[model samples]
Target: MVDRLFRMKTKSIFVRLPLLFIFFDAVRCDYFPTLYPRESETREIKELNGLWNFRADMSVNRSQGFEEKWFMSRLEKTGPVIPMPVPSSYNDVTQDKSLRDFTGWVWYDKEFFCHYHGKDRGSYTGTVYWMITTNSEEAKVQVEVVDADSNTVVMGEGIKGQASVSNVKLWWPYSMVKTGAAYMYVLKVTVKDSTSASTDIYRQPFGFRTVNKTNTQLLINNKPFYCHGVAKHEDYDLRGKGLDMVSVAKDFNILKWLGVNCFRTSHYPYAEEIMDQADQQGIVVIDESPAIGLLQQVYNLTKALDPTRLVTFASSNSNPLSDHVMNIVDVVMVNIYFGWYQDTGYLQTIPYQVPPTLEGLYKHYNKPVMVSEYGAETLTGLHTSPSFTFSEEYQKDLLIQYHQEYDKLRHEYLAGEMIWNFADFLIDQKTNWAYGCNKGLFTRHRQPKMAAFTVRERYQKMINETQKYQN
Candidate 1:
């Protein structure tokens, strides 16, 4: 785990909210902030990850919170005040059993720093950017940034958009610029819209980075791409899928140590802070939606934000929608567990399954195919003489089978290949040994198994070989 010694150079800037009385109307406005950084310009950012005042309306009986302008400031009259953490779901925070299940209108408020240098404010624009990873269609969210004197500064209505600010710094990701530090500004988000009866607000660190894809390569900052990485889940023992900064930081450190260049938010999208860190650390991300229900409309909605990035409908099992999903996406990706689960053949047969799948998809679609997932489950510390199921030896061999073939094929039709899992994760109790999916190269606690070394050795070799093309 990484030590907590890495302090952010940027300090928190406290700004007070203003009581701006806007005319309330029955008609709802659906406009989102579309202003953001241009290709040549990087914008300033402010992280709102600390404590915030929270209130949850469980019974769906709350209009006073909005009428009284609760988002403008902390509402002292509304029940007991709960200190909620931003960039996390409110479902898993409180000890009160009712609060954990309570999911009506939740509001969050925090103060952050922004450079509002009175008059010299040039053409620079500041934006309040955040993502609503998981939410109901009925869930209405709004973000408002206010000045210290309680005047509304900038606000965004929907999931993503930018409010224009004339004076702010640019957010530079780590390793992208050697001389500059990551500078961020302050902003606020409010869910209780004066025009709506619902409120669901969220806050987190925000930044921007450039990502693009070619016929057979993914590029970040115009660098020749090779993603020697793994797919990850947000699962932890107690937090379950809730955002935990310590856990996120530790996982990032592990990625750095493992020489991983990228990762996919397997199964679902990650918290805003994690994505923000990925931008800061120069780690590429393949943000995915939930499994099985691969909706193209939602994927299109996300991809609309940045056309440069590639979006894939992550289809795991043999879904009939695979062909339809692959047609719309920029890349063809499918999760195959051929030799492990169903196609129970020897490791040699793995090559037959992988290449043919990619070739068939490419022949039809003429798009780059990527192996999004492929792995065999193996118990930690378990081994066998000749190699068998649930044995570490078998796990290592299975990964080798996939990697050796992927290395050979990447030059032609393959784009990138991400292993099924980076670490063992807790699932339901019905799962085999350890009460979780044990296909990870690392144990749940992040202990490296034999498969970790197998991939590490392979990845290091792949990294070295790919560097030649980078020149």
Candidate 2:
């Protein structure tokens, strides 16, 4: 859920030695896990989505689990255990108040039966290629293309491939043009071995889209695109970061109702299931890596691996004029809290301060600029007439100010604007966090505040304007 740096302290002097060794070793490690798991004809997947035995390390030093080797045996054997959901956060599942605020290693145990099949084993080699099939009613065509890594593949190796489809339907954001739907094509891959008479087939669904950027515009499929979006986190009431299909469907439905076209996975990559829904719903995603604070290295490595998509990091620095990494990024994304954090209660100064900052960043970098984050924290059901801080009115008024500034710069260098949050989420208790950050346009339960209506109106207007222009 929340991103925070952890520092382990102990009386032992050898702790630093192993940590330092790990730090250096990690720099040399280049292998990264597959982003998403898939099932093919030859490969099978089992869902581990039910209850599991759970226990938290409540010892004084919080190292009792490691000392007792709790993972080696059932959690109930070591002590009394509770049933916790596998993909959910362990914090908010019980009645104990201490468990809700626990910050230590938690152990989980699950038992499942897997049947092993014994077949004739031999050296297996295969040729893998891609077949693109159109699933639309208006068009039905299939084309075969060679894999980028060529046709040859060993038994345990993965192959990379790409193909071009002619007369393809482009993936568009929600209601961008003619109430467009997310058009995706099936990429069927077949691996065949002539000797073993073994074959594997996998079908991957992907949308045919291209992203580009000019000095003052962000283009999707070579058409100018605007992001009337929000930054989101995977937090829920009792489920926390758990994978719940009901919640996922509800969130996507609300996003459509709000006329939102895009969203950024605030500080890290989201669950693959959420991404699948994004593709199906035609929502643009600004996918982010985990928050490690190495933007330049992340940019370089990601660009080197896949140079097709535009890459940019969200800058929280108030002063963008002196930002050092602006030149290396594809777009300038700044999380400016002009009225909320900086000016603090001075809502009138937002218009004066925001425009100059955006202009400065655009002129300096000569790239498209975006206000990736801007919002005020307002408690649900709290209201004040004159737009005082911590009131719903203040939050609504602050967003209006930011939108005013965005409109002035939209056609020039401002490419997009995304509010700070889509909904309220859980975080560690702190001085500023009342339960958690209340900056969301909607509450933690997905109930809209007054600001949500404002955003919806503005976004719908933008969509209508874009549609008219395209026509």
Candidate 3:
């Protein structure tokens, strides 16, 4: 396990939510439905996405605590309880504004009833399906959906076998079923640490969807299509997950108006409501992991070439091992900050490969891997020397560098790319790097920067310059 030192960044977004237990207000908005219809695929899903239990473990308690049997046993005896909510960060339970620091290990659990009325039109196999997910390489945990209301346990099984084992029954997008029927599916996630355990269980809705990527393309129902999608943020001005349905619904309306055929959840996963609206709108999703803002220092590649590193698959699919369970491209959103920061030579790290690693993640996960959000930050740092300045010469070179790099993978592995941003939004303004100019194809309001026109012309040309094959 890579040990990432947990330190709250001086300016982080987690600090937005207020730490307080306010009375649960009463304003009834319909809960997001988890199921829809797909003519050639499965439908009907239950979304287990409501209140869930949560807890975070400090690192010190884990690494050193793992060696002591008594200490480990003591933690297992009483699982830690953090907070409970649906589809938000685990820090929802604490006052630690920066959920980044609470990263060691966390847990979530919930309970529900099961109901799989009967197989659909064909291949009617009578069997129950259970699915679980976590961050640990290998986890030992059990989930039980018991009906204490009726004094009976419906589904109670420990999940600790392998990655494929967990993929027993996968959900495909617009193919198999739109949703999974859960009369009541409760969840209990126990992310075990050496001497500390974080467990969260609660009632929420969960519907399964299977996604597949193939033939340098992607399909929702075995149909080839181009996904004109955007990586969206929660709400431009809302604080925390403090979004209202009216706002979410409005975004959906905007998407429909814009003629978007797909939606990628950017770097992080999103709330259940967002997924429901997308499915309903027939918008395909690249559904990326919860990662963004690659503002970091770069390191030099060790001169010694290690074959192991060369052959490892770079599937950024939050769950590297869940390959069998869900189709997700492990995309590396290469930005100037994420890797090889200061090293001007690091740009040569293209065609990065790890042996026969799925040839490419899109093929492996049956999904197109996108450079969803990437571009040289216009203002990573200012001109240091007398002649150094943020000039068109510098910008042209920087833009052309990444464009040329990804261009090689065009017919090879990559699906497409979305520049760091379309326009400088509210978030960029908050960053220290913002000095009127930063990451954006357009200015803050909506004016296209010179680079914007370049992106349009280059991208449109790529679209028009497709090579046709003859057998």
Name the top TM-score candidate: 2
TM-score, structure 1 vs. true = 0.58
Predicted structure 2, TM vs. truth: 0.67
- TM-scores of the candidates are 0.58, 0.67, 0.35
Off by over 4 Å in 1: 1-209, 291-294, 317-322, 431-434, 464-471
Model 1, range 250-341, lDDT digits (tens) per residue?
57756755656668998777898788767655566888776455466776777688656577765663343345566777877778887798
lDDT of 2 by residue, 248-324 (tens): 76687678778889899988899998898898778899998864568778887888776776988888764655667
Model 3, 62-178: lDDT tens digits are: 443233322222232235433245555544323245553565545344433332222132232122344566556455455443222222233454553311112222223221233
Assess candidate 3 and give its TM-score to the true structure. 0.35
The order by descending lDDT is 2, 1, 3
Candidate 3 runs further than 4 Å off? 1-211, 215-217, 223-230, 235-263, 271-283, 288-369, 379-397, 425-432, 435-437, 443-447, 459-471
Q: What C-alpha lDDT, on a 0 to 100 scale, does residue 326 get in candidate 3?
A: 31
Error of 1 at 44 (Å): 25
RMSD in Å for all candidates: 16.4, 18.1, 20.7
**Candidate 1 global CA lDDT score:** 0.63
